[model samples]
Target: MTIADLHTLTGAYAVGALPEREAADFRGHLTRCAACAQEVREFRETAARLALAVAEVPPAALRVRVMAALPEVRQLPPVPAGARGRVVSLRDRRWRHRLPYLAAAACLVAAAVATGVAVEARRDADTQRDRGVVAEQRARVVSALAAAPDAAFHTGALTGGGSATVVSSTRLGAAAILYRDLPPLPGSRVYELWYSRDDVMVPAGLVDTKDPSGSLLLQGHPNGAVGVGVTVEPHGGSDTPSGSPLVVVPL
Candidate 1:
């Protein structure tokens, strides 16, 4: 179905008020169409909220009146005499036709509201995830610093590249990494931190202080690094060493 058709039926889809055939057809269309899917999601959200806000059922008298007013004309068996068209009052027919439209509009409004809520919920989840990453990095740094041979060395420099402050204990063995004063790497390269132990090098991780001279704090030292080294490598550090050392601090 075309986008215009979907728009016309958006309310019906939101309220689930479409005829079975029409509903099925629309569902098929939505599956293949991105725009319609988005519209349906929005409309459904709006419809749900409207339903809750209007929790009270229609008055019994109104319902009864509508039911009672249905045309009472009987349908006779197909025959020559029954073949003539029975004229339905223009006014009654018009009102009957308008009902679906009204219902659809209500559903559409509800769907819109629902979509908004969903978007907001997704945004909140993303923000929470970002915060979690930062917290996790902080923990790693704290642990590394604690692993330092000397507790005093656990302190990270805030001289300007980036700063590292111990967030938790490393008594169990972990080192926190924090430093400032270095330049930004090129697009094709990255700055990596490393820890050396007994001449064996252990890769730390990629860091981002953002400023060439800005103090960038990183997660702590590796499990057994006796010395700290910074190196430039491809965006991500390699398992085996590649590139020249940028800085080296002996333990």
Candidate 2:
């Protein structure tokens, strides 16, 4: 089905815990999804190693302890009909016949690597150029905020979670807000920042909550805004704040 649906089955697939239908779906997906298949194989190998770590003592009492600690095993899902023929062996003997091509490929790969390095060097240069532009823009905003009056910007504790701060210039009419000490959010939701100039509320950039120590950087100086707010919203956010504000640091 969908990637999210497939993701739900990853743990079960890794542990061979799926039912017939679910397992079959996972297997069918595995054929095309190299990344997921690799993860599953790695997880399976780790589990097998963990199982082997228990001491293999001859005492009959040891069996009771092992069985008691063991988690219930789920049945493997049925292999999809599309998963025909034997699994391809990583160490196929067919490669032996292509040693020459393999060597040629290796040389080509070396050349490609050199070419890649050159490409990356150019990209780095371009990135630096873009960063310079962004830095100039940021400097101008900060300078404007510095000149503005009634601008209060300081980091403070989160209501029940993390901490945030706002820097603004009521005179210059601009603000920059930053937040820290937030937990990661599930993929279903994203945290958003907002600015209120008097009665009208304007959106700030979405906060990145993927990090355990989340940080959000937003730059927007709403006209005639006296208050600011932060809220947890659906991904991509909305024109109006739908969810309750997690943090409200007044400017």
Instruction: Highest TM-score: give the candidate number.
Output: 2
Candidate lDDT scores, in order, read 0.53, 0.61
Model 1 per-residue lDDT at 53: 25
Could you tell me how far off, in angstroms, the CA of residue 126 lies in candidate 2 after the best superposition?
Answer: 2.4
User: What does candidate 2's lDDT look like per residue over 1-251, in tens digits?
Assistant: 67677865654576655678988988999898888788677555433432332213234543554454333322334657875666655565476467668767766766665565557556666766675565556544543443232444555566668776666655666666545557667777877778865666689788656643422336565566666787778888888989677767776
Q: Compute the lDDT of residue 158 as modeled in candidate 2.
A: 63
How do the predictions measure up, each by TM-score? 0.43, 0.47
lDDT of 1: 0.53
**Residue 62 of model 2: what lDDT?**
38
Task: Give the Cα-based TM-score of candidate 2 against the true structure.
Answer: 0.47
- How many pairs of residues collide in model 1? 41
Candidate 1 per-residue lDDT, tens place, 1-251, comes to 55666556654575566779988888888788887678667655433432332223323554454344333322323535653576658996896599678667766665665565557556666766775566556543433333222332433442225433221223435543445445555686767777777786677667663534322333454445556666777866677579556555654
- Identify the runs in model 2 with alpha carbons over 4 angstroms from their true place: 1-112, 147-150, 197-200, 210-220
